[model samples]
Target chain A: MAMVEIRDARKVFDGGFEALRGASLDIEEGEILALLGPNGAGKTTLISAICGITQPTSGTIAVGGHDVVKDYRAARNLVGLVPQEVNLEPFEKVWKTVRFSRGLFGRKPDDALLERILRKLSLWEKRGATIKSLSGGMKRRVLIAKALAHDPRVLFLDEPTAGVDVELRRDMWDTVAELKREGVTIILTTHYIEEAEALADRVAVINRGQILLVEDKDALMARMGRKTLRIELDEPVAEIPAGLSDYGLRLEDDGRVLVYDYDTSAERTGIARLMGALAAEGIVVRDVATSQNSLEDIFVGLVHDGQEEEGVA
Target chain B: MNWAAVAAIYRFEMSRFFRTLLQSFISPVISTSLYFVVFGGAIGSRIDQVEGVSYGAFIVPGLVMLTVIMQAISNASFGIYFPKFIGTIYELLSAPINFLEIVMGYVGAAATKALFIGVVILVTSSFFVDLTIQHPLAMVAFLLLTCVSFALLGFIIGIWAGNFEQLQLVPLLVVTPLVFLGGSFYSIEMLPEVWQTITLFNPVLYLISGFRWAFFGLSDVPVGWSLAAIALFTSLCLTAIWWIFRTGWRIRS
Candidate 1:
C-alpha cells in the first residue's frame, strides 16, 4: 500500500504566493523518492503540507491512510521530517532531545531503543553534551536521529545535506540508504542532482509548483538524456564559416572548439558527417572527446524547456 | 491531550531552562533582593503603613506577584521565541504532539520557572520585612494562578511575534507598563477616586490585590471580589490561548 498520497494539493499563502499548484503524487512504502527542483520550486512547501505542519489551500493528503487534516495525530505519527534547518533545543542534552522527540509521538520511553538510535547516528559518545556544544555535522546528525527516534514508517528529508561538507554528505547518504534498507520509505528534496541520481529509486522533477515528471531513475536517464561531442581545434577560427551551421554546432570561445549536442534517443548522431564538414572547413581537430548524459544535463534541459514554455505563456 | 507527550516536552523544556543554573537562579534572587532594598527599604522610610501593616511588609505580596508575572511572561516567551529564531519550530510542528501539548509543555515549563522564582522571592523578602501570610492556602492559590495565567499570556505573545524585537515588545513595553501602573508598589486607595476607578481596569491590579489580601488579610477592595476578578481573567486568558493553538495562529503555514 502507498504510505503517502497527495491529491491535487495546492497552497496559497496569505500574501497570495501560490507555492504549490495542484501537485499530486503517490509514495509507495519502502521506496526512496527524490524530489529534484530549483529554488522556489515548492519542494519544502509540499513536504510541509504532507507533514501537517501547514494546511493546504485545497486538496487532500493522507499518510498511512490517515488524512493530514482530519486525523493529524495518526498521520503525523506515521511520518518524521528532518527539516533543512538545524532546530534542536540548544540547552538540552543530545540524548534528551532525541528521546523527547520519540515521546512527542506519544511513544513510551524505551532506553534500549533510544540508545540504539543514538549509537546508530554515532552520537552516543556525546549523549550528555548540550546541543549548542555539538559541531555542525554532528548537529545535522542529531536532527536525523531525532527524526528516527519515533520510528516512523516514512521520513521526509528536505535538503538534508545542503551546506554540509563532502565527507559528511557521503555519510548522510549512506545512513539514508541504510534506513531505506530497513524498510523506511524516504522522500528527499535536493539541489544536488548527483545525490538524487545516486540514491533515489525514483526521480520526480518539479518546476514552478508543477511536477514535470516522476519516473524510475534508470528508465528516465535512459529515455530523455543526451550525449555531446566537444571538439577542440589546434587553432581558433573566426566563425563557423556558414557551411557547418546546419549540424546544430555551437562555437565556443571564438571557435576554439565546436560543440555538438545530440539526443541519445536518436538513431544516429551524425558524428562522421560533422567531422567531414569540420575537415572541409580546414579546421583540424587536435582532440575530440565524447561525454555521456548525466542527471545534471537532463535537469538543465528540463529547466530550460520549462523556462521556454513559461516565456511562450 | 496526550499526557505522555505533555510530560516529555515539559520535562525537556524545564531541563533546558535549568541548564543555565547560575543565570536562572541568581538573576531572580538578585533582582528580587534589589526590589526589596530599593522599594521596601528606601521608599518605605517615608511612607506610612497601609491597613495597619508597615509599608515594607504591606508591599511584599505585590512585589512577589510582580516578579512572578514578569518571570512567567519572560520565560514562556523566550522558550517559544528561541526555537523560532533557530528555525527549530519546523521540528516541533512536524512532531506528533498536538498544539495543546506543545503549549502545555513550553508554558508549563515557564510557569514552573516563575513558581520557583516566586517562592525564592517570598523567602528572600522575609529577610527584608516582617511579612506574614494571613491565609496560607489563599496565598498559594493566588501565586499559582497568577503564574499560570501570565505564562499563557506570554505564550500568546511568543506566537504573535515574528522576530526577537517583537518578542521584547509586549513583555517589556506593554505588560510591564500595565503592571507598574497596576499599583504593585502602592495601593489604589492612595490614588484619587478617579484613578482608583481606572486602576480597576488593569488586570494585574486584581491579581496583585488578590495576592495582597491573602498576605495581610486586608485590601482596598473586598478579598472575594479580587479573587473573582483574577479567576475570571485566568479563565479568559486560558480560553484565548486554547483558541490560538487550535487555530494555529501565526505558528502554522
Candidate 2:
C-alpha cells in the first residue's frame, strides 16, 4: 500500500483563492516523489494540506492509513516536513533545536540517537552555537536536522534548494538519497526540473492550482516532453525557403540556424527525415545536434501555453 | 498530551532566554527597580497612603504585578513571534507535536520568565521598602497564577500578531494602558463615586487588589472575588488560546 495517499483534495483560502483544485496523488513507500511547478502552482499548498498545516477545502488524505484530520496525531507522527524558509529560534543552539524538535513529536530523548543525527548532518561540531551565528546553509541544515529528529517514515521538503549554494544543494541531494536508503518516503517540491530529474521516481507538475500531469520520471520525459533538432548553416541567409515550411522550420539569427521540435514519444522522431529534407531544400547543415527537452522546458511550455490560453479568453 | 515534548520545548525556550543572561535577566530587574525608585520613592513623597499603607509600600505589589505582566507579555509574545518571523514555526507545526503541546511549551516558558522576574522584583522591592508578606503561600500562589495567566494571554497575542510592531501593540497600547488605569498606582476610593464604580470593571484591578490583600490583608475588592476573577480569566484565556492554536488561526493557515 502507498504510504501517503491524497485523494481529490481541494484548498480554497479565506479570500476565495483556490490554491489546490481537486488534486490527488499517491506516494509509494520509500520512494522519492518530486512535485514540480511554477510559483502559485499550489505545490506548497498541497504539501501543507497533506502535512495538516492547512485543512483542505474538501477531500480525504491519509498517511499510513491515518486520516490527516481525524487521526492527525498518527498521521503527523508518520511524516516530517522541511519548509522553504529557514525558521529556528535564533538564540537556540543547533543541538537543542534538533532535540526539542524530537520532543515535540512526543518522543523520548535519546542522547545517542541525537548525536547520530547531528553527526550525520555534519552539524555535530556547530551543535552548541546559537542559530543566529550560523550561515544560511548551516541554518538550512538545522531545519533538515530538526525534521529528521523525530525519525519519521515520511519527509516533505518544500523548495529544499531554492536559494542554496551548488555545493550545499549537492550535499542535500546526497542526504536525501541517504534518507531514501533508510526506507523513508520523501516528497519534495522544486522549480528546478533537473533536481526532480535527478532524484524523483515519480514527478507531478502543477500549474494554477491544477495538476497538469503526474507520471514516472522517465516516461513523462519520453511522453509529453519534446526534443529539438538544430542545424547551423555554413552561411547566413535572409529567410527560410518556402519548401521547408512543411518541416515547421524556425529561422534563427538571420536564418543561420534552423530548429525543429518533434515529439519524442512518436514511434519515429523523424530526425533523419528532417535532415534529409533540409538537404533537399539546398540548406547545407554544417553542424547538427539533437537536444532532448528537459523537464524545465516542458514545464515552461505547459504553463506558458496555459497563460496564453487564459489571455485569449 | 506529551509531557516529554512539553518539557523539552519548555526547557529549550527557557534556556534561550537565560542564554542572553545579562540582557534577559538583569535588564527587566533594573528597569523595574527604576520604576520603583521614580514612581514609588520620588512620587510617593507628596502622596499619602492611598489605602491605609505607605505610599511607597502601596505601589509595591502593583509594581511587582506590573513587572510580572510586562515580562510575561514581552517574553511570551517574542518567544512565539520570533519563531514565526524566522520561519521555524513550520518545523514545529509539521512536527508530531500537537497544538496543545506547542501552547503548553511556549506558555510554560513565558510563565517561567514571569515567575523569575516576579521573584527578582520582589527581592529588589525589599531594598527600598519595608514590607511584609501577610500570607506567604497566597502571595506565591497569586504571583504564579497571575504570571501564568498573562503568559498564556501573551502567547495568544504573539500567535495572532504578524509583525514585531503588532506584537508591541498589545503590551504598549492595550496592557500598559489597562495596567495604568486599573488602579495599580491609586486606590479606587480616591476617585469620584462614578469612576470608583467603573474601576471595579478593570480586570487588572482585581489582580493588584488580590495581591495587595495577600500582602497586607487589605484590598479594594474582596480577596475571594479577586481570586475567582483571576482564575476565571486564566481559564478563559487558556481555552481561547488553545482553540486558536488548534484551528491554526493566523499561525499556520
Candidate 3:
C-alpha cells in the first residue's frame, strides 16, 4: 500500500472558498514526491488535510494505510509536518521545542533521539538558545528538528526553503536527502521547480485546487520536455527559406540564425533532414547548439493550460 | 490518553508561568495585600463587623475567589491564545492527541497556575487578618473546582478571541463586574431587598457564598446552591468546548 493515500480530498473554508477540489494522489513509501503548484493552488490545504490539521469537507486521506480522519492517531503518528510558517514559542529553548513535538505525538521521552535530531539539523550547539534569539535560518532548522524528533515514517515539508539563503537551502536539501536514505517517505511542496527536479523521484503538479498531473519526474520531463536546436548562419537572411517550411523553423538574430524545436524522445528529430534541406538551399551554417527544456517550462505550460481551460469553461 | 503530550504541554505552560514569576506569583500576592489594606483596613475601621465576623476576616474568601477566578481565566486564556497567535497551535492540532488531551494539557496547566496563586493569596491574607477555616476540606474543594471550571471557560475565551482586545473583553467587561457585584468584598445582604435579589442572579455570587461558608460558615446562599451553580457552569463550558472541537471552530479553521 502507498505510504500516503489521498482519495478525492476536498476542503471548503468557512467563506465558501474551496481550497482542495477532488484532489487525489498516492505517495509511495521511501520516495521523495514534490508537490508543485503556484500560490493558492491548494498545496498547503492538501498537506493540512493529510496531517489532520484541517478536516476535509469531503472524501478521505490516509497515511501509512490508516485513514487520517477515521484513524487519525495512527495516521498522524506516522507523519510529521514542517509547516510553511516558522511558528515557535519565542521564549522556548530549541531543545524543549523539539522535545515538545515528540511528546505531542504520544511518543515517550527519548532525550537521546531528540539530541540526535537536533544535532542532525545543526541545532545542538544552539539548543539552549530561545527561538526568538536565533537567526531566521536557525529557526527554520529548529522546525525541521521538531518534525524529526518523533522519528516519523513520512514527513511533509510545506515550502521548507521558501525564503532561505542559498547555503541554508542546500543544507536543507541535504537533510531531506539523508532522511530519504533512512527509508522515510517525503512529500514536499515547493514553488521552486529546480528544487523538485533536483530532489523528487515523482512530481505532482496541482493548480486551482486540483491535481493536474502526477508522474515520474524524469518521465514527465521526457514526455513533455522539448529541445531546441539553434543554427547560426554564415550570413544574415531576411526571412526563413521556403525549403525549410516543412521543419517549421524560425529565423532569429536578424535572420542570421534558425531555431527548431523537437521532442527528444522522437525517433527522428528531423534535425539532419533540416540541415540537408538548408544545405540544398545554399544556406551556409556556421555553428549548431542544442538546449533541453527545464522543468520550469513544463510546469509553467501545465499551469497556464489549466488556467486557460478554467477561463474557457 | 497521550499523557506525555499532556505533560509536555503542561510543563511548557508552567515554564512560561515561572518565567514571569513576578507577574504570576508576586503581583497577585501584592494585590491581595493591597486589597487587605483597602477593604480590611480602611473599610474595617468603619464597619467593624459583618454578621459577627470581623470585617478583616470576612473578605478572605472573597479575595481568594477574586484572585483565583482572574488568574485561572487569564492564565488559561493566554496559555492557549499565545500558541494560536504565534501559529504554533498547528503542531498541537496536527499531533496524534485528541481534543480532550489538548484541553487537558492547557486547561490543566492553567488551573494549576491559578491554584498556586489562590494558595499564595490565602497565605497573604492570613498575614493581614486572623483567619479560620470552618471547613478546610470544603475550601480546598471549592478552590479546586473554581480553578478547573474557570480555566475551562478561559480556554473557550482564548479560542473565541481573534485579537488581544477581544481576549481581554470578557474578563474586563463581564467577569470583573460580575465578581464585584457578586459580594466579593461585601455581603449581598448589605444591599437593598431588590438589589439583594438581583445579586443572587450573578453566578459568581454562589461561588463566593459557598467559599465563604467553607471559611466562616457564613453564606449568602445555601452551600448546595453554590455547588450546583458551579457544576452547571462547568458543564456549560465543557459542552461549548465539545461543540467547538466537533465543528472545527476557530481553532481548527
**Winner by DockQ:** 3
Screening candidate 1 with a backbone cut-off below 3 angstroms (N, C-alpha, C), the clashing residue pairs are none
Q: Which residue pairs in candidate 3 collide?
A: none
Q: On residues A20-109, what C-alpha lDDT tens digit does candidate 3 reach at each position?
A: 999999999999999999998999999999998899999988898899989988999999899999999898898888888888888888
- Give a tens-digit lDDT track for model 3, residues B123-162: 8888888999999999999999999999999999999999
Model 2 lDDT tens row, B103-197: 88898899888888788888888887888889999999999999889988898888889888999999998899878877787887888999888
Cα lDDT tens digits, model 2, A1-313, are 7899889899989899999888888889999999888888899999999887788989999999999988888999998888887777777788888888888888988778889888888999998899999989888888888888888999999999989999999999999999999999999999888899999999988887777777899887888777788889998868878767777878887788988888877898778887777788787779978888888887788788877878932
Please provide, for model 1 over B1-253, each residue's C-alpha lDDT reduced to its tens digit, 9 standing for 90 to 100. 6788889878877876667878878877898788878887788888868768898888788878888998899889888878777777887788766777888888899999999999988888888878778899999999998888888888888888888899889888888888888878898888999999988888788888888888887776777877788778778877887787677787786
Candidate 1 local Cα displacement, residue B108, angstroms: 1.1
List model 1 lDDT by residue over A1-313, tens digit each. Answer: 5889988999999899999999989899999999998899999999999987788989999999999988888899889899888777777789888888888888898889889888888899999999899999999899999899889899999999989999999989999999999999999999999899989999998887878888999889879877889999999988777888898888897779888988777888788888898889888899998888899888878877988988942
Q: Which ten residues in a row have the lowest lDDT in candidate 2 chain B?
A: B91-100
- Every candidate's fraction of true contacts kept comes to 0.80, 0.85, 0.97
For every candidate in turn, the CA RMSD to the true structure comes to 3.5, 3.2, 1.2
After the best TM-score superposition of candidate 1, give how far the Cα of residue B161 lies from its true spot, in angstroms: 2.4
Indicate whether candidate 2 or candidate 3 has the larger lDDT: 3
Q: Model 1's lDDT to the true fold?
A: 0.86
Report the Cα lDDT for residue B38, model 2: 85
